[model samples]
Target: MATGDNLTTTAYIQHHLQNLTFGLHPENGWSFATSAEQATEMGFWAIHVDTMAWSIGLGILFLWVFRMAAKTATTGVPSGLQNFVEMMVEFVDNSVRETFHGKSKLIAPLSLTIFCWIFLMNLMDLVPVDFLPMLAQKIGALFGADPSHVYFKVVPTTDVNATLGMSLSVFALIIFYSIREKGFSGFVAELTLHPFNASNPFVQALLIPVNFLLEAVTLLAKPVSLALRLFGNLYAGELIFILIAMVGLWQLPLHFAWATFHILIITLQAFIFMMLTIVYLSMASEKH
Candidate 1:
């Protein structure tokens, strides 16, 4: 029974990690109707379902941690979880204070949430690639499907859609804050006139159009840059893991080595995303 086919080598590792895409059908042709249909057909939906569950689960867990820490307030001494939460809170507060001069009530808490949520999502990379997928496959088999047909990817950050979705949300918040701080006319004037003020009515009109266009492009670039930076690092890291896994049993040590190194990449990418978020919000709060 112990044959070469039964061995979980690198090729098997890479194959299991690959995404189940919808476009450009394989030799078998289009097997499902909708994208969701295709996902269900290949058990890709299982991965999405599991990712959502885990992300939300982790979020709720952290929320409870903060809530409990807040409720059990102590002035004399701090211990265990309180000390840990206090340290993280102080770090986030410092970043917020340095980067943003706006109200602490909103900005500080938002930054803290961003850091914690993103860190939890990034931590998913630490989980063995095969662990959750295998569990999902087994669950699917019990529901009358073949385990071999189950296809799932548990890492949320590896998903471009998910990462871009988060970036876009920050993008929307930036716009909201800009409008709130500047007022509608003040915001429009800043975009169209402040950067290229002209005393004469004729010159002002001409410069306004050009300035607005430039400002619009600059605003658009922020979210795109934010989205791509996060997506690129995470996707590349996931790809490297897959490639390394393909190196067979002899490369086990190398695989562990790369995984250890990737821990830094994960944390750095999350921190970069958070910093960019703060920078963008700060820019939005500016006069021009």
Candidate 2:
């Protein structure tokens, strides 16, 4: 075991990285997983409770703060919160204007929500990694639960499922608008036609399978790439934070230095996710 913490380096790292999962256990039936091994046993049906709770909580917070800002907004030299909210709104509005050429009013609000919600979620990583988890462990202790079994990961974006859920949502919108803009035949043709069309109908027929294979991979990659990119970046960042915490006395300085640089990574990732969603939807909405 390491000095201050009773866990070894490997155990400490694992503890910080694991999510508080809840699902149906074969023997225990429906219950919360107290450990990563138990979580794995809980299987495909298991949900990351911490991820869902934090993501939803931050989403509601974003909405509430923005709503309050909107309510308290004034034309006469607006307050600080209103100014900040307006600035964020303008930032997203401009990003959408530049990137999305689509006609739908949904893009602007959606972009704003995506940017703010994701930024807020990523923002959780800036908190000391052990802080919330330790708090959770203490809370568990009060309930007669072992501290060793309490797992809680604060940053939602670090979880692949959270990122994948958001990306799959954008993917659904992409498909919906693609079909709406180009019709069912046009959508099917997009997958089966062009990108390698032939003048002869017979040759074009042969190209359909190849074209569909290529296009299907391309279509699927949108969500897969979006999810992995966000997950990979944040997961690496979280891992580094966990590693740094193992350094004992010198963790604070290193944490600050890394966090200072990480702020850019966090904001950039959210912006990239937002921009990609807009661009993918824009491509879908276009009458090509």
lDDT (CA) per prediction:
0.73, 0.92
Best by lDDT: 2
- CA error at residue 202 for candidate 1, angstroms: 2.4
Candidate 2 per-residue C-alpha lDDT over 66-168 given as tens digits, one digit per residue, 9 for 90 to 100: 9999998988998899999999999989988997876888989999999999999999999988888888888988999888888899999999999999999
Kindly provide the TM-score of model 2 when superposed on the true structure, using C-alpha atoms.
Answer: 0.96
Query: What TM-score does each of the candidates earn?
Result: 0.83, 0.96
Worst 10 residues of 1 by lDDT: 25-34
- Stretches off by above 4 angstroms in model 1 are 1-47
Task: Supply every candidate's count of residue pairs whose N, Cα or C atoms clash at under 3 angstroms.
Answer: 1, 0
